[model samples]
Target: MRTPHSHNFAGKTRVSVLLACAALLAGCKKEPAAGPVPGGDAQQGLRLVTQYQCGACHTIPGVQGAAGEQAPSLAHIGRLSYIAGGIPNHPANMMQWLRTPHAVKPGTEMPPMGLTEQEARHMAAFLYTLR
Candidate 1:
């Protein structure tokens, strides 16, 4: 004959086990593929990067003459987990950073490139291809 306290303990144990399983599943989730971004054109993005002269600060891979050392090299930006050191490296986040970096992270050295939505998307698509 179990007491009321015993029943409560059993329930709590079940809850704890469920929570642990959920945590484990979440941890096991795979990272997203470094594929092309939807509705974005990598070729157009390359053009935009060239037009904007992003190589002036960032060392982009595909674009020729993109050998600037003032900022970090985007050799494999797609594999990176974070942008601006905090923002998640998702397509939306990357586009936002490219459009208005100051809005995403105040006082960031990356200045806003004044990119429209489509341009940002294209840029993100190209950047993701670096992986």
Candidate 2:
């Protein structure tokens, strides 16, 4: 039997099925890898953080007496999408920033502490574990 209400019901069912399929496909998508940052050690990184005295200008968790208000808090830095609220939040980018904050962001208050490549890598490793 054909009726106006029956046609609307059929259209609604088709739309519902399409939406359900789209959701199922989205759920099946794989997530990005969450492994340790390459060539970086969290423990060594933590030590370097203390050695560099980063706590003096920045608030860092797990570092005693790192309660600085000059810079942003690094409690969950790993979860941040970008560094300095501008650059992408990736290991390579982070290392570069740590090594050369002035070059990355000119006229900035953060100074170049003269960190070696190894030191930057270790610092990046420690920062990535904040999440």
Top candidate when judged by lDDT against the true structure: 1
Best candidate (score: TM-score): 1
For each candidate, the alpha-carbon lDDT, in order, equals: 0.86, 0.82
Model 2, residue pairs in steric clash: none
Off by over 4 Å in 1: 1-29, 33-35
Question: Model 2, 1-131: lDDT tens per residue?
Answer: 57999999999988976776586575532321222478999999999898888999899999977888899998988878787869878888888899999888888788888999989998888998887
Stretches > 4 Å off in candidate 2 = 1-35
The root-mean-square deviation over C-alpha atoms between each candidate and the true structure, in angstroms, is 10.5, 12.9
Angstrom error of the Cα, residue 123, model 2: value is: 0.6
In terms of lDDT, the poorest run of 10 residues in model 1 is: 27-36
